[model samples]
Target chain A: MKKLIMIFSLGILFLLSACAGENSASGNSSQSTGNKNSEAGTKDGKQVVTFWHSMGGAGQETLNSIVEDFNNSQDKVQVNAEYQGTYDESLTKFNAVAGTDSAPTMIQTFEIGTMSMINSGNIIPIQEFVDKDGYDMSGLEGNITNYYSLDGKFYSMPFNSSTPVMYYNKDAFKKAGLDPEKAPETFEEVEEASKAIVKSNPNMKGFALQAYGWLWEQLLANQGALLLNNDNGRTDTPTKIGWTEKEGKSIFEWVKRMVDDGTFANYGTNGDNMVAGFLAGDVAMFLQSSASARDVIDNAPFEVGIAFLPYPEDQERQGVVIGGASLWMIDGKPKEESKAAWEFMKYLQTPEVQAKWHVGTGYFAVNPAAYEEDVVKEAWAEKPQLQVTVQQLQSTKSSYATQGALMDMLPQGRKIMETALETVYNGGEVDQAYKTAVQQFNDAIEQANKARKK
Target chain B: MSMNPTLETNETYMYQFERVKKSARMKSFIKGMLFLFPSILLFSVFVFYPMFKTIYLSFYLTDAKGSTTVFVGLENYLNMFTNPIFLQSIKNTFLFVFYTVPPTVLISLFLAILANENLRGIGLFRTIYSSTIGISVAAASVFWLYLFNPTMGLLNKFLEAFGGEPVGWLTDPAWALLSVSVTTIWMNIGFTFLILLGGLQSIDRSLYESAEVEGSGYFYKLRRITIPMLSPTLFFVITVSMINSFQTFGQIDILTQGGPANETSLIVYSIYREAFVNYQFGSASAQAVVLFILILVMTVIQFKLGERRVHYQ
Candidate 1:
């Protein structure tokens, strides 16, 4: 019995020591990455800049190649780009390690995360770097730059920007006796098109809208409607949702009309499934990010038509908000490491790199000069649909609605709207769903403010 | 008074004897504690500390970093009860448990009984029956996700082939929770089956021999002997399966993501969304505390009521 006790104690000691070792090893690595009060540590005489991004698939491949090019361009900095799941997941992780040594030198956060990243108190605004470096901000695209800057101060460097565009099967339009070149431009038009498509082919649905909060916001913006109050939370903090009852309810009612007609396909909160549905000829048209242009065009058996986001007939098209991520420099990093990351960020803004990014993924070139590049010219010549996404952004009327809302609660608010949209798709009364969503959204914003007061 | 000297000496002797016995008992207690020290230390760091922290955080409003900002007292708890989403989540969780547990237990028991029979190639059949236990939750969920896809899923294809309208397996509000529950039940059956089969094999062969010699029919013997003998395992499997159903997360995440208007958002998934996604750690902690109490009460009730029927040979 005594011998058995000794062995058991020894075994436990071994496990405890192993756990301690693992903890210390992780602690050491984080410290080495974010060295404070000391010169930023170098790997092989090159400053290491850890960049956490949330780009997957083709975007990831393009980003990795760009990083490789940046690394090979000079020997002074070795930028390590890490793919950190989705925007939601990576943001959660960043929140957990925001001020800690484990935090990256820089992080790419989604457009909606801009307000939270600024409020996080763990980042250095891009305005400082721009001023210090004398970088020409005017060279970037106006619509893209407008989304990133607040009060003429850039908080983050816009990267991989996109906008919502309507993708439709051109072949289905021809078969339905509708003009193949002209896509639906208004909510009523889309409904009519859906009816025509369904009338042409009973197996195919006329339209599909994935129950997504981003799409809902884009649809509202396309109608020149704001998402949150207080000038879309730009001039002041938002207290409630910005859109009027009519503006908000129009989207629901339009979807309800489609549902009532049995021409709407609902893919609840699953974008991939919606895309698959489109590819399988189950749905003729859908609204999705322009970033999916290359994938959709390449995979579709039919000619895919990319068009501007549809709006209500009464409201003029207000265009779309930049719908991708931006890079923010983390605080508490050494000046040299930040400068190195800044250099890489500038490299990403160059016309050559942006052109590659634009052609490689359906995302817009933050630098408009990239549109002048031969690569972009050749790609557009081959597939004219890609240019429609860029044209929409260029034509956007800059307003508080198109600039998009700023609030940490936007993500939560999105979830509320998504649930509301799902209710409408599932045949719930539009007024009831809209009212419940607005109430819950206001409560979330109020709760957020109350939480922040202390 | 002088004649009581012997009695007084006897009292002092008894006091010394009691003191020695007390010290000896204390030594044994210390030794036992020493033997239990490892597990106690591990549990204190991992389980007990976190549990107490969760309870402590439940009363305070926390910032994005999860640090306490304001003392809200019972506000978080009160808000949860009034929150329709939370209430729906609780109802859905109970519904999911009902949908999954009995089916899992019954089907696994039926499979276990069939696989327990002495027959040729029984090992191969047992392997096939228990194969899913080797598959991880993530892999199994992804497999089911493809099968449940609304557009190009095998299920929809089969329905279309039969000239039936395609059902939105994971898209419709009424069907999403049931679809997730079906995936969970399929994933759970293998582990439950293996455990039940092990229990079936451990039963004394002579008991079955006597039942057969008495000319008791198959169904009769199974009712009188097999079920009574397997009662202990059945009780254990039911309790565990119930708890597992209550805590189901992975399949729901992969399959439904608590979508179609939050129909499949179970308690744990709701708590996750509240804390990690919404960053409402205070309310999440309150929900966690409620879930803890719920699971504790359920387990206590099971122990009290179930143990009476468990025949431990």
Candidate 2:
């Protein structure tokens, strides 16, 4: 009788647990209606929108201010802003919510995902709202749309756009008998400086190049090499990899030499060790996204310096490709809600906000007009080091590789490179490694392309 | 036929209900089915459906706009087999499992025995020894990474006091994987320890008393009685350890990131890189399917071995 009672209770508990799992509510209840910033918050029948952004610290504060301003100006809706953990987490949550059709009306997605998000039938085109509203989109700088426009149709709003740059230790350079002011202009010069720095200071490493292929992609495209075949790797069927050619091979060899000689550390073979290494003072120079500047500054105990990205010898360079995330608008949301989102996006793009974002974070202002604006100009004058990215933009032209990478299996291509890089960094034969990696990556790409034919 | 029609109808309804209620095997099967149905449905949607979809997808072409999935039998499999990194990753994973599982299980067993002894303060010692399990893999790995740094690391610092040269734990490819393995064993020892301890405590004390009456020493009694009685727990611990070792990702990712070289590229991490980081979902799914098959084979082998050898009273 006791055993039967125990069994019956266990069964009862299990059923109750299962029901509880479904009934459990999500992260927020209030924002499911609309944002706290909506003008409707001021009057009756107002909608409330919940927005999840990964931007925190000062970025969150700025967004809160924008929300406050919008709330003060409007009388119909309140936009509630919440901080999501990271870009990856936000997208994962977005994907999950999208299935439930309860997704946040606005999200901050990274640039690499913008095209894929559009093609996934997940998002509404921002161009529609712009064309219909006839809001002064003319205020938007040309470069800002470079992230959102796919086949001339805007898929999302641009936020937190960034390009890679070379950040060096000025004091370390001075100690190594290199110029603190006159940074390396060519890749060879950079290599020489790195070698010199390592030789002079045994405790100090030269370069923190995380993924050599990514760095190679940056330099190769800068040197006018088409890194990908078939519409320059843009959301289309890729016939072949242009990196298989001599120019691409040369870039890999140079990196291999740097790795072999121990002049360059690739962190964890195929990982994001460079940023940590640089910040830890393990290396003297770091090649990374401008977006990393905030963390590096906050974390680094050393004197920091910013410089234009180094180029190959005698190769006039186009600008370094932008390598940050963008926000994509999802469909299935009500028209009014999307319009509420649109208002927030437009407000975010304003010069005052963009300038403030640029100052707090080292990311380049997507709004080129932000450069001409008084606040930004004053900030630049006060801190001349901030203009290094803008200088790269003026010099560099966007390449097929630079504009965007297109692949059915884009991520696998990078993994292949990461593996090859790790192999060689850990003492595997170089030529054999890249050859093997290239074949496998291409194979994965081919297999992926075939799989998408449903 | 001679009975009233209502009585006959009542009899049939009772028979159907009794059929469902009796035959414990049938009842249990139906109950199990009902119990597992929700999880099965979820797994089908998230795991199996995607898996079959990938198998379906592996033969087609995809882009930003649309996908054209077609039948390309054996091509994806052939391609993966020919790939060196994939091949290396499989080998690396096996090596990692081999390195981590035995030492981990044995050391944990040793600790469990020590902790199981009826000392004055045994409970305190057990708690202290088992506390490492609570530290998250990321946090523990971060602490270990700094401690294991070749130069200026605490380990090297202690070693240098003995007049030894600093060893690069993570910098050198040869040692990086093992460095990660040591941390894994340390991190995992507590879990296996607890299992073996529970097994030891549950052993019939009378078995040990009988061994003692036979004039057995501590070691002899341990070998003769305790081990035999604890074989079930040992089997469980070994199986769990091996499965957990095969699934090693967080430590490898946080510490070595499958590198210094591809020394630490476990199969699942490689699968993750392909699926999320590289956006090669189809091949990643293929890899996952292969990994699942491998795991299934391992599990089946374990159960078969356990059936043959495991002694339970």
Candidate 3:
């Protein structure tokens, strides 16, 4: 009888858990409906805009406060900002609920996700709102507008923007007898500096490049090389990679030379660790997103100097593509809710809010006029490193390569490049790694194109 | 006429007996089904449906939303076999299982034996031995991630203090899998230890007492009596550990993310990357099917070969 009772209880427990699992899955799918009902039933007359973002840490804090300010500034719309993990995770969640009523009022997606977002048919083009409101998008930063716009049409509102910059230890440069004021502007110069730094202090490695695909893209752009065929996939669907062997192999061979000299620090795909290593003085220089400028500048014990992204000596500097996310208005939302979201997005673009955003986070102000704001001027005065990021963006040549590639398969391409970069970092043959990466990248592009047909 | 009537009555009596037996059998079968209904419902909803869906999806191409896009029979499976990264992941997963399973079982068994002693503070030692069961995979992996950090991590600092060069635990392709395996073994020990300790304690004391009376030594009794008695628990632990290691995802995600030239990208992580990250559900489903078959075959072989050795006392 006891054994029978035990089995019976275990069965009950299993049944309950199974039911719970089903309930939760349904709950996720029905979240928007639940939210809508609650908002409608609320006593307040204000419309609710469910805003989803992928900001974390300092960025999240600043974004939340900005939302609160926007809510308090007016009673017509109450924007609820929800953090939805990293860009990859958030995009995955958005994909799951894309066409369903469970989707949020609006979402912030990374730049590489632009093509996929447009193709998903789950987002309303921001151009409709721009035309209706007669919003002057030209007032936004030119480089940012270039990246967010395609054929003079805005599909998404440009929010936070950043570029790749070389962060170096000025103290280490001085100690190595290199001029602290003048930074390395070419790959060959960086290599020479790295060797000097390592020779001066064997304890500190010369350079660290976190095996990140976005950085690879930036490096390619700086060398005037396109990442995809047909004008970086802007003219037509890309069939294969665009960069020449010399353009692609220059970056790899540079890193390989440094590695052979034992001056390269391999942090292998973990940006946090590379930054940590930099702060801990294990490395003298590294390349990373300018969005991390504030964190790196504040944490480093030594004098930090920010410089332009280095290009190959054989190629001219073409500058960097915008490396950040944009605000997308989700489709299928109520007209009132979308209008409220649009209002919040407009509020975010004003010089005051953009200034606050730029000062609070290392991300560039989408509105160029934000630089005139006192807060931004004061912040830039204190940390001139922030000014370099804006300068880099402003100086970026208006080319299709610098405008970045448009493809649904960029995220997959990134992983392929990251793996190839890691292979090179771990002492694999560069030619072999590059060949495999290119093959996989082209295959991914083809597969993505095929998958979209049905 | 009287003889005919008696024969008819006898036939009716036998027919009634047969009908009664059939009705009783039907009633018992209904009762058994009623008892099994809950489990059947759960399994159908969770397991059978997904298994069938995965198999069906393995024959098609899917879009980002996971809806079937094209009917390409066996294309997804063939592509997986041809893909070098997928082949590498398979090799890494099997290597991970080999690296993690035996050591986890053996180390836990050793700890269980030691903690099973009747010392004054044996409870404390047992608690310490089994404490890792409380630490979640994410939290434990994060902890080990810091310990394995090349620059400021405690492990590297210790190595440097010993006058040895720092090693990239997760960065070097040669060491990344070994590093991940070490973390898995550490995380798996607590549960295995507790289970083995329970098995050790529940063994008949009389068997040990009789062995002691026969003037047998510790190793002799452990080999002849204890091992045979504990074989069932050992077998259970081994099987669970093997399955758990094969399905390892959290630690790999947190620690390595299948990095260092895809050396640490095991089967499950690869599936997640394919389905979620790359948004290719068809190929991911095919990989899942392969993994399912692999685990099923291995488990079947283990049960077939291992059950003969287990003494289920």
Q: Considering every candidate listed, which one attains the maximal DockQ?
A: 3
Q: Candidates 2 and 3: which is better by TM-score?
A: 3
Residues B1-313 of candidate 2 have per-residue lDDT tens digits of 3889999999999998888778877889999999999978976765556557756766543343224345455555676797666787899888888889899888988899999888998889999888888988889999998887644479878977998865668756778778988999999898889888998999988888887888889998888778887877787777667667766677876777666556678887777555545545555557766776776577568767764566677
RMSD score of candidate 2 (Å): 6.5
- Label model 3 with its docking quality class: acceptable
Listed per model, the TM-scores of chain A against the true chain A are 0.92, 0.83, 0.93
Candidate 1's C-alpha runs over 4 A off are A1-40, B1-7
lDDT of 3 at A367: 95
The residue-by-residue lDDT of candidate 2 on A90-176, one tens digit each, is 654465456344577777776546545765677788888888988666565455555356677777777777777888888889999
Candidate 1 lDDT over residue span A30-136, tens digit each: 44544431234588889889898999988999999999999999999998888777898778878877887678889999999998888889999999999999999
DockQ comparisons of all candidates to the true complex: 0.40, 0.28, 0.46
Question: Can you write out model 1's per-residue Cα lDDT over B1-313, one digit (the tens) per residue?
Answer: 3658888899999999999999999999999999999988986776667778888999988877788888999999999999989999999999999999999999999999999999999999999989999998899999999999988899999999999999999989889999998999899899999989998998999998988898999999888888888987787778777777877777887888898899899998898888877888899989988987787677668767877777777
Model 2: CA > 4 A from native: A1-46, A50-77, A81-89, A136-141, A144-147, A212-214, A234-236, A269-273, A372-378, A398-401, B1-68, B71-78, B135-172, B278-282, B303-309
Error of 2 at A426 (Å): 2.2
Ten-residue segment with the worst summed lDDT in candidate 1 chain B? B42-51
Candidate 2 CA-lDDT value: 0.68
User: For residue A70, what is the lDDT in candidate 1?
Assistant: 91
